[model samples]
Target chain A: MSATIHRLDNRPQPSLEPMVQLVAQDMNLVNAVILDRMQSEIPLIPELAGHLIAGGGKRMRPMLTLASAKLLGYPGNRHHRLAAAVEFIHTATLLHDDVVDGSDLRRGKRTANLIWGNPASVLVGDFLFSRSFELMVEDGSLKVLKILSSASAIIAEGEVNQLTAARRLDIGEQRYLDIIGAKTAALFAAACRIAAVVAERPEAEEAALDAYGRNLGIAFQLVDDAIDYVSDADTMGKDAGDDFREGKMTLPVILAFARGSEEDRRFWQAAIHGHRTSDADFAQAVSLIRGARAVEDTLARARHYGQRAIDALGLFAGGKAKDAMIEAVEFAIGRAY
Target chain B: MSATIHRLDNRPQPSLEPMVQLVAQDMNLVNAVILDRMQSEIPLIPELAGHLIAGGGKRMRPMLTLASAKLLGYPGNRHHRLAAAVEFIHTATLLHDDVVDGSDLRRGKRTANLIWGNPASVLVGDFLFSRSFELMVEDGSLKVLKILSSASAIIAEGEVNQLTAARRLDIGEQRYLDIIGAKTAALFAAACRIAAVVAERPEAEEAALDAYGRNLGIAFQLVDDAIDYVSDADTMGKDAGDDFREGKMTLPVILAFARGSEEDRRFWQAAIHGHRTSDADFAQAVSLIRGARAVEDTLARARHYGQRAIDALGLFAGGKAKDAMIEAVEFAIGRAY
Candidate 1:
């Protein structure tokens, strides 16, 4: 276990480059499938989808698929198509999410919903989702299909759960975990699990990768939430306090509210319920969060999940694949700083 | 062929009752699957989904699946779950459609989007869609998966296609057929075709059922478009000119534009482009449509498809199932009058 442990502090900086480099050749195939399958006779389908697909996303989920496959020594191209399907599912969710959140900017650019309006965004998202299923069906693996379709349902359920929990100060850490678990981690888990499946590995191996992806996903989301309070638009790509502006409940806010004094709690209540919104309000909110050490604790939580994620890959043999996978977790956690 | 022919005029009124009765017992099982699968830990999922699912939809697509199964003399319970899956897909599309169209009323009730907001509608629609695939995956039929998944993609493509075509006075009849054939008829075809696959029927029979459902769906849409001009909300269960107000292009408008005099063409161009939208404008539009005989010609087109739908069933043996299926087509077209 000690031998498999790859410490992040041993290096000056942790990066996603290792995973991206490990899967570089495979990533090309996945990208091709994404570009090819996203095409439709309708000009807008390709034009709008291309805006995001061609947009500078890290392809994190699909990269996980390729790297996991490489780690297992899986010698097949099935994961390439499957990886594209994962990205499509992710893209579809992003499209709907932008509409749901009414987000104007994503990854430092205007959202598809912002450019095309919500109606086109919704329809095209539906298209990509259906296309993802079609890709799965073409792969013709019931096991893979079941995993993805179930993950998709869980993600949607989680989204609806989060939607219902919005602006409510009473939502606790456990409920928040449940929401992110379903919404963010489910796909991450499925993305890695399918690699095991396509590799025809044992159930134990599949479970290990699933654990790896899931914990990493939770860490990934936690760090994103934390970064919103700590960083601004240029560095983060997503604007800081965008979640606060949308009144999204995250770990930082929940912890701050729970740990705040009477006046601080009143400020949070106003902020969550929509009374507090401007840059000054966000600045104050950040100060309150810092005072409560909410962001620090949030980063601590991300470290917990990131460690679990790293530990999950321990059972696999030590190699470049494992190092990249472990470092990917680090990069996810490292993003907030 | 002569013995199988059942004309609409043979009865005082054609109704959806016979087909509904033919599939009544089977629909009960399908309904159970729908209710059971739509549930989640999140309360809003069920509450919001139930608002639309239990709303007064006629269950047309699933009923076609059941009746087509009966027509094939397939003795199996598999179609019930699959039928529910089909319904789930339809419901998901309706939820998204409401958001896309900003529709206020459906089946004489306020839309779920109107009640719950667009975000909830979008998320719940995605949930239902994923649940539909999960049900199909549980059934473990790759062929059915291919058909439904493909159809879902086509439906979404059609929707996007229609979005681009909206309010454009230049869109003609062929493109409209292509659009409806996708958005409406593809699901209808897949719904009927999957029953044959579950029944283990040959390709010819599957194609026959597909043809039957496709034509019926086209006829259904034509009649629906025509009724929007000829009937009121009390009878039609949807507000007349709602499409017109929204600047939707249907066969009626295309034909009206194609056949109208220059003066009339200018009115339609203005109406479609948003210069005309009021009770008075709709009344004037209705008069112009009547003067151009667009509604009459639209119903004529519906009957043409209805005849094709009936003829597609001619390959099957004449019996209660066939009669009900044929009558369903008649009921579809007869709604216009």
Candidate 2:
């Protein structure tokens, strides 16, 4: 345990020169494993999946899975399998979510829905989801299955809650937290936690890893919400203020709306509940948010969660994997520009 | 073994006077359990779920689950949990399917889509899917989870295959069978097979029961397809030739189109492929199908599967439950009118 702690704490930051070289070297291996696992015995599946997997989105979830497993001193190569499963689940959900939301833009390109139609996108999403389970089953660990299945269920439930909560201006922070935790963090936590489980770590170590993942997930989502208002469409690879356009009740907007005057409430009601918003409304809302310092407040909360994520990693011994995870948390908060 | 054989063969048909009486007596109890299980700790979920469950579905999947368990000589009540889980899965799929298909009608009523909108319907469907998994996990059998999860994955895949097969007139019978089996029959087979697993039946008996279920599911889906062409919208609770309208490539149409003359193929291409169909086109297509004996051919296939389903029961002993299963298969094919 002493040696483990020393290794983890003394680990050099991967984003720094020496560790950066190490990650660069391993990146190709990880990418190859991801590509291999994404291939399906069913030709149609692999074709559809390849369309998305090769579509150039960041492999954030899989990176976390691989890093966490390595950090936990995994001797086996099965982390790559779990990592691919994580990405597949994420990709599948994105496909379905885009269709459900009727969004045409993703990653600064036309979504699958825009290219192939919603039905094709949806069915392909289902294909990926099923294929993911097949991959997980190949691992042949009941615990892994249980964790992944439970996380999948939670993720679905959260999405449902968010859908129900949409356009309801009264949505509180607690409900918002619950929704994002389920929709975003549940999978992120499960990705890392399951990696630890696969590595056969002690229960406490697993718990620490799970906490680290959960807080990181929270921070990531919070940062995402904060960036929604400010990031350019080209940079975010999605429409700026898209959440506002969709009447999605996010943290800053919800908080700002709660603190608004009667006139402000009427403005928001007309813009959101009325399902009509112009650039003027968007500008006004942005000004209102800035005036209220909601962005700063939200960013503060994100930083708090991000720090908590880093702190949780301290429960485990230090290593290159832990350092990478810590840097990933920081990157999630500030590097999305 | 002798008792098992007796139980299988001596099962009563629900159409029989005694069996009808028994079903009537137990319907309330089954309905109660289903309602109880459908309740979510989340308030909005139960209300949303109730909108569909109370909308008067026949509860066929749950009935199958309960019937299979009882037939297998299970004395305990865990089957109720599994039965409820089966119905939840079925209902969840329906909600999602309607959203995917943009369907406005189901079971002669306005669909959840019409009532709640697509986003709500989609999310609620997800909620039900997750809730079903939660219920299955509570039964504390990894085997049950494996069966249900696999069924879910297969069903989703089948849907994707069906979507791809849609409007592709070149799709063969084998492809059609695979699509339908995945989309509809897979869950049906799983429902009964899981029941057998729960009962901890002998390996040979379990395999026999699974075969019976698979064949029964095929027959059931075949009858459903047949009903789509022949039954009135009022009776079928869907539009007449709605599959054709939606450009779905069901069996009779596939068979008719495959064997039709060039002129007939042109008419199908115009109606199905080109998505242009007049009343004359509908009438001509129906007549061509009848002329080609495609419907009859499909019925023959259905009957063959139905008979196979009944014969599979020969492995089990004669009993009320077994008799009911055999009769159920007969009713599925015979009562297609």
The candidate that achieves the highest DockQ relative to the unseen native structure: 1
Evaluate every candidate with DockQ and list the scores. 0.96, 0.41
Q: Provide the overall lDDT of each model, using Cα atoms, as 2-decimal numbers.
A: 0.93, 0.75
Clashes (backbone N, CA, C under 3 Å), per candidate, total 0, 29
Candidate 2, residue B26: Cα displacement in angstroms equals 8.3
Model 1, residue pairs in steric clash? none
The C-alpha stretches of model 2 lying farther than 4 A from their native spots are A1-44, A274-276, B1-37, B277-281
CAPRI band for model 1: high
Question: Could you list the chain B TM-scores for each candidate?
Answer: 0.98, 0.91
lDDT of 2 by residue, B86-162 (tens): 88888888987887777877888888878877766766666666667667766767777777777887887788777
For all candidates in order, state the fraction of native interface contacts they contain: 0.97, 0.41
What is the iRMS for every candidate structure? 0.4, 2.7
Q: What value of lDDT does candidate 1 attain over all alpha carbons?
A: 0.93
Weakest ten-residue segment in model 1 chain B by summed lDDT? B1-10
